[model samples]
Target: MEITAKVPETSLKIKQKAIVIGGSIAGLLIARVLTDYFDQVTIVERDRFPDEPQPRSGVPQSHQLHVLLTQGYRTLNQLFPGLEEELASWDVYTLNWTADLKWLLPGGWSPHFPSELKTQSCSRNLLEFLIRKRLAAYSNLEFKETTIVTGLLLNPNRTAVEGVKLRHSNGTETQLTAQFIVDASGRNSQTPQWLKSLGYEPPQETIVNAFLGYSTRWYEYAGNEPLDYKALYLMPRAPHQSRGGVLYRVEGNRWIIGLIGVGKDYPPTDEVGFLEFARSLRNSEVYEAIKNAQPISPIYGYRRTENRLRHYEGLSRFPNNFVVVGDAVCVFNPVYGQGMTVAGLAALLLDQCFKQHTKSNSNPDLKNLGKQFQKKLALANKVPWLMATGEDLRWFTTEGEQPSVMTRFLQWYIEQVIFLASDQAEVYQAFMEVIHMTKPSTVFFRPSILLSVMRRMLSRHHKS
Candidate 1:
């Protein structure tokens, strides 16, 4: 990893440093954004980053099936140009989501057609690896592997974060002072406790757990000929079937099969149980794809699928120069595949806020910067959070507050959208655009789309 030119410290008049905890995707993207403002950006991680595209200890779900939505894909391209081509060099496959994926929605099978909703298909390890590799081109960015961030160092008034105290794997402890600190440490972040210890109240939390769990296995699948699509999604129908599965094409001519069960009925990791769970899915496509494929790894099971949101934006008091992003603030149900995309949007928002803050002040005074950004991030999270929670609430076993009347109406309309998408290419494209986060949810309410939905509904009703 080499950079064309080094940004010398002498050229930086501000002499500010930004420290980001965790070297995962969120942290890496934050570091990338900070390089434009801060003179130095250091990333602290508890686990050493592997040199190759392989899973590390810190990211437990790296081995699972991960999809980069359209919005995230575009963001990565904007942040690191030519990344898609580079990923292709690594054998990463690119496919149009609607055209290439065979999705079995609750209404019916989604119609296959070409659309602008293209995505990259590969393991999370490869995606992280490419992002980290791209970061090496920035002279101001640094990574401190095997270093755990213990807590934050605050100002004399305890109202602003100065830096972070960290402990290395060798048992050595030190404090690095930074003008800004960001916590992107995933779902197990200790920010809440750290804030409470600093005499500040923790943000209100909302948890909506569906008791969703999944088991995944990788295989060297040489599929039988006549394979038309690159991916298969067997979605679970609520109130009737609680089992679902997906088969995705990954690098190295491999396929990753994931079996999902909701309502505390988790898929098992044992060989027989794994196959049995696949066979029990809503459809036979997942089982058929992996029935004869040679599995290359043991089944990995994960169960932390709850949708959690911390209302940090609503807090009356919060320290300046410190902000939380990614799963630390909001963790979505993985079944929706919205986590990475939301994190990407947050990073982009961080960049935007910095620009706004600088334009308003001459010396980049960050007064209320953390609070303002958190509020905006919360707004950015509105759609995805509602979408995930609304879908999760469909199951009677899901534990959460009842949906509002408006929410129920929207859900019903979305169901109609899904049913129309089964055969109508226009409706399918609009729906996919929204789900991919490239367009607003209001697209479903467009006059043309609503008319299509109404016609489809009336036709079905008359036939019945």
Candidate 2:
């Protein structure tokens, strides 16, 4: 989608207003896009945002290691120009994923070469703070913090959402009306219950859980170590080696190390067990790098890693003038680092849908906009959802629908691609591109890659 496209003059003349629930990265991005098309945009957040780049009570995963994939970084730069420079001023490290990362795959170490897949390494707190700062500069935007959205306010026919009923921190209740409303609330969204209360059938849900968990700790970086790579990733081989870890260098001269475990082998919050978990990874690079690092923060544990998709698009009837985005509609396992990037893509999609609506209709109407957007958004989220769930299903402990034949074949093909990536720079770059969402999975289907994969498979088959 052309995110920088100019909003039609007709759109600006309309007295339209938009309200976004939750002040998350997705909500902030949606509000930024709505500012261009709507006369007013208000963000309703349950928690008061922090003045500085610090974790707030609303986002529990703020202290963990967060990665902005290549596409996500580019999308942010597009939305907020000079974002990279601003992050650089804050000491956020921008590194090429291929060259600056030491990634140990299931087979072995992946090949490292200079590539265009560069990403920002920073804490979630800092990224959200910077995005919110940028959004504050817009005159058409406003933030309603320390307020809870109690329920949806529907019109007389109850076919469209006219507004939201909000309860302030002081227990005062009020209704805020808007032409359009979006729910960007994270995994704990209550939109389903609200819809059911209004006599609407809730969307069907699909959940794939691997029972994965991770514990993270921050270490002060003195810049005296002889590390060649800027980041380290040790992936756990499924079904056997179920432990992994990552050491990411973020802003403020600090390293956020996350020790991960799958299949209900949750990482412990205590320091001793955290280190022991890291020490048990398939590779010791993460452990060795942080073994003697100066610790700066307590070990924080998180266990709600699951791939969930609320099939909002499949709903036969949805409220008009209302839509859902981000974790409210679908949430993926964070281990693949697809959440922020997918959210960015969804924001861009929202912008595109609005632009198209304005062009197609003489008097742009949002009567069925929610349904249209949800349908397109479901198509957009398919690849990432499949990618995350496919990987999780490799473990026997994962609970979800059984993998189909095509899914199993794709799994085997991807394993071959990863095995080839261990020794082939070209294959590694292609895999990284797909993983970063810069290229489609068809990249692996090219003649050269196909030949290499087939030859390797055939050779191993003959030997067996």
**Candidate topping TM-score:** 2
lDDT of 2 at 386: 82
What is the clash tally of candidate 1? Answer: 0
Question: Each prediction's Cα lDDT score?
Answer: 0.88, 0.89
Residue pairs clashing in model 1 are none
Q: Which candidate number maximizes lDDT? A: 2
Q: Please provide TM-scores, in order, for all candidate models, with all chains considered together.
A: 0.96, 0.97
**Candidate 1 lDDT (Cα, 0 to 1):** 0.88
In the range 165-279, model 2's lDDT, one tens digit per residue, is: 9999999999999989999989999999999999999999999999999899999988886888899888988888888888899989899898889999998999788778778
List clashing residue pairs in candidate 2: none
Worst 10 residues of 1 by lDDT: 1-10
Give the alpha carbon lDDT tens digit for every residue of 38-103 in model 1: 888999999989999998889999979898899999988887777888888878788899989999
